[model samples]
Target chain A: MPENEFEKKLKKMMDDFHLPPSTSVWENVSRRLHEKRRRKIPFFFLLAAGLITAGYFTYHVSEKYKQNSTAAISYTGKNADKAGNYLLKDSAKLSTQKPGIKKEEKASVSNTLPGTQQKIFKNELNNKLITVKNSTALKDNSSELENDNAGNNKQHLNGQIINENNNAIVSNNETLFKNSITIKQPVTPADAENTLLKDEVQDNNLALKKDSISGLANQPGNSLKKSTTKTPVTINKTSNWQWGVTGLYAKSNLIENLTNLNIPSAQYSNDPLTSGNYDTAFKTTHAFSPSAAYAFGTVVKKKIFKNGYLSSGLNFIHLSVKADIGKTVDSVIVIPSPAYTYFVRGYAQPGFVKTNTSKYNFIELPVLFQQNFFHSKKTSLSYNAGFSVRQLISSSSLIYNQINNIYFSKEELLRKTQFQVAAGLSFEMNTGKNNSFFIGPQFTYSLSNLIKNPGNSSFHFINYGLQAGFLLHKK
Target chain B: MDYKNLVRNCLKGNAEAQKYLYNHFAASMFGVCYRYTKSVTDAEDVLQEGFIKVFNNLHRYRHEGELQAWMRRIMVNTALTYLKQNKHYSSELSYEEINLHPVSSENPVITLQAKELADLIRQLPTGCQTIFNLHAVEGYTHVEIGEMLGIHEGTSRSQYARARSIMVGWIEKRNENIKQRRYAGK
Candidate 1:
């Protein structure tokens, strides 16, 4: 072909030239379309989780405040006279004892008493009944009091009944008056057992005294009427904030459609003398293989409502994908230039047995709301849902070109940031106080395209995997 | 599907219609991408991005011209944008730097496949390739190309001329190699 003819032919051939993109391109586009649709849907799950958590916390705190206020009111009213009588008896017992008891010893004695007795003791001490005593017998008596309480019916005694029990009154007076100065002695387990035995004996004596007091209260001469008011015991429940670290593993596959594109082809004849005509058409197809992804991160969670929590965390993720482009051309013809004379043998056919491997690293931030549906002392089951933002830290790809007989590697031009939605269920086992081990299955779907070029295949990743971690909590 | 119905369905966000449109024109559009980019992968990137723009902005089509022509224009603009953003092309090329020597053959001719010709074109400088593609293949005038590329019209013509001269020299050398190979074989 001459220069002018060649130019004209080239123009005509260029119009007919068609080269189909790799199949992964459509997959990329489809993935991006799905992401756009997902992003378009309002974050209703997150909003609902937030509203429910807020309502629960508000209701719970209000109920607790109401209970506390009611308890305060009852303590100050209706029980006032009974508390006054107990305070008078405590003052009388303290005055009868030695007058030199140390304040530190008094504090230790107060600390050792049971909850109800400690309140009565605090009231008596507040009424100016303090005495400084450096006596070993007083220490012994306080230890005896502790043992008596420890060995008793495992129930709290009422404040009003402390003065009414005759044997308890006698023990209190003896502990106060006895000033025997025993020298320092080594404490032994046998001595401790003996002390416990003595405590049991005192408890028996107290029971008898309680019987006597009941008899007296029934008598018409008794001025103090038996108090009928019963104080309810309240158990305090404290919620804690927890933090954890997790390692995760996932497997993902590319979702896309397969399509072929046409390329220029040449038909060869058997005769060496005749040149071949470029009438044939060639085509190629592309596909992706499954890939594995890994991630690790730390999370901090705060208890919001009863059995509910809000958590946020940062994660580092590594993702990889492999793609293959199949057979494209049948052969190439080399023609020497000057005379347009060339011997053509089948050579340099564009067979695209090529693989492209792409890897990405990202920093992800996630906010989630978790609710515990079932719980026990040792175990609980919960569900969580949230959204996350992922920023690409780095991305790279290695391309194997069979025709070129070389490996090409380069940094990929991917989107700097992406978004995802995540939801999961977890089973937590309380291993110790304020500590737990949790294992769960989680699912994450991309809400944005991974590549920068909108014209390129839109790549999105869907990951599902098991996440396990240990949580430490502070109340 | 016919182009009119396909366009209507695509406007309604019909996936099948979109796929049909893509399948129908992906190859020819890819050829245009290949002419502008450095590698097949880069070309595929341009093709995908171009189609996305086409799909997203389909409602803007007023049916004023051929659909292929409209899409081709988008692909060209997209390729140019990719080049500019990635800094793949230099800002300018001086006329003195270009090989302006003309080949001696009065009626020089060479036999080459379309793919081979495209490869030779890819070997040209980025500025020359953009100018040649816009002027010769895409049928854009120097004035239009200059407006699109933000350069002078004369600069576009000069770049195209330099590209043509380089290609002619390559063809002459290729022809000489063939003649020598034939003589050696004989």
Candidate 2:
């Protein structure tokens, strides 16, 4: 049957038909075409703003906590000063009134008196109330305090009768001294730590008070009790900046999404017709494998919040992707032109058993936000998430061209800069007061395509790595 | 400047060259989009998407074909993709396999204006309308249309036949109205 004349007329008329589009069509199209380049600017600005806001919030919270801590220290110091001055006044009165007290009674009094109190009394009363002799008097006092348990509640300090209300004079008995000082029995195994384990105090009188407690703890009968709440204080040095060097080893994988780039299937495969269609180039017939990758660089980290930190650094990353290309053989192709014949030397592909490797190296700057969820005095565990802006330093590979049927440098197709998303958790061990060592597993994936003009094909690399680093704090 | 030079400048990210290229081909491309889509707004959407693809894939053009022809194919593909994915058109484009009787081959002279003809075509059921445009207007064979639209070749042929008969009925009715109006003027 002949084609319908109606269809012929319709085609002719439609071919000539033209309707002017609304002006907004161009506006939309133009905006979309240019938006790719402009999109990054706003994203980076938003990220920076977010970081700044988070840092500011963390700083204020940490400062408020520090202020509250300082207030606690001052409150504890004031009470210690009051106790010290009161003891000094009572010792003076005891020395004048207790002139006829026997040596036996004086020795008993020294057994219950704390060392700081005894030292103060000796100074104020001209060595009449209590005296410090290296081993002889102190040793006898320790044994006497233990055997005199029956008389623990009542004690005579320089023959002054002290009442239970704690107003008359300082006690020479273990029970009265414990009630007056509020110093619990030594809870630490170490004799030194028993006194130092108390919350940190800067006042001189408080230091002397703790020292006197240590003297009591050293007595022969005193038993060291186990301290169940042994908290090792971890100072968040949020204001201090730290610098570090990091190194990573990873397994890298390449992801390819073909869009418009022509794939020379004929060069890699024996079939020439396969090179014409877009799908043939992207088909899973070609195998791409990953090898070892490494990254190394210096980083600077600063604490932003009580548990948050913002860190950025420069790193050099070396990545390798291997493609299976059967057995490789040398081949020369002769090109015929009007006036010249060009000879191009390259590799010949047979099957998919052999492999070839390609190297892509990048210099990257990363901005990472880390928050520590767990902290001990000597160790901390934190998770970090952020992005990196990377510049392609070099690429080494021969790319196949469908149009020319020849090999070209892949550098021509690769973009200069790309972006990546990175996330990881780190376990940090504080080696010294101002230094730490950290190690963790990290994963980084590319956000931008590797190809400069990824017409139909998008290429990216994903890396799974173990990162280790050392940080030195700068005070 | 010539199209080759214009394309080269566009590749260099020259805004003026891109605008020039869009201005040169946008009207014809919009006409193509309008035929495939349901409304003027939908046509413009496809036109916008199509032009972006054209510019992004401009490097692959290879200068082997007319730039206008290359862009038109992109627009056509973009329209078909829009029809399948767009909620407004996806139900309309869903084709059911039904037997269609052959339409009359006797020519009914169609003297309607091009815009009038396009409007009538738009009024056809979207499934048949697309198959009609693909096979009748775009010159794709029934087999190619089946492959492009992911349907059986027989279904495409039947849908096109149904689309043609509906179009003829609309054209004939409009001709009768014109005739009556002319007689009243006399």
Instruction: Evaluate candidate 1 and give its CAPRI docking class based on DockQ.
Output: acceptable
| Top-scoring candidate (TM-score) | 2
TM-score of each: 0.39, 0.42
lDDT of 2 by residue, A253-369 (tens): 666532432222433443433432334443334334668899999988876545677888789999887665534333444434432233334443423444567788988878898
True contacts kept of each: 0.51, 0.74
Q: After superposition, how far is residue A70 of candidate 1 from its true place, in Å?
A: 7.5
DockQ of each: 0.24, 0.27
Give residue A397's lDDT in candidate 2 (0 to 100).
60
How do the residues B2-104 of candidate 2 rate in per-residue lDDT, one tens digit apiece?
Answer: 7889999999989999999999899899889999987887888789889999998999998888887788889989999988866567856866767867766
Candidate number with greatest lDDT: 2
The fraction of reference A/B contacts recovered in model 1 reads: 0.51
**Model 1 stretches with alpha carbons more than 4 Å out:** A1-475, B1-5, B11-13, B37-42, B56-66, B81-126, B141-154, B166-186
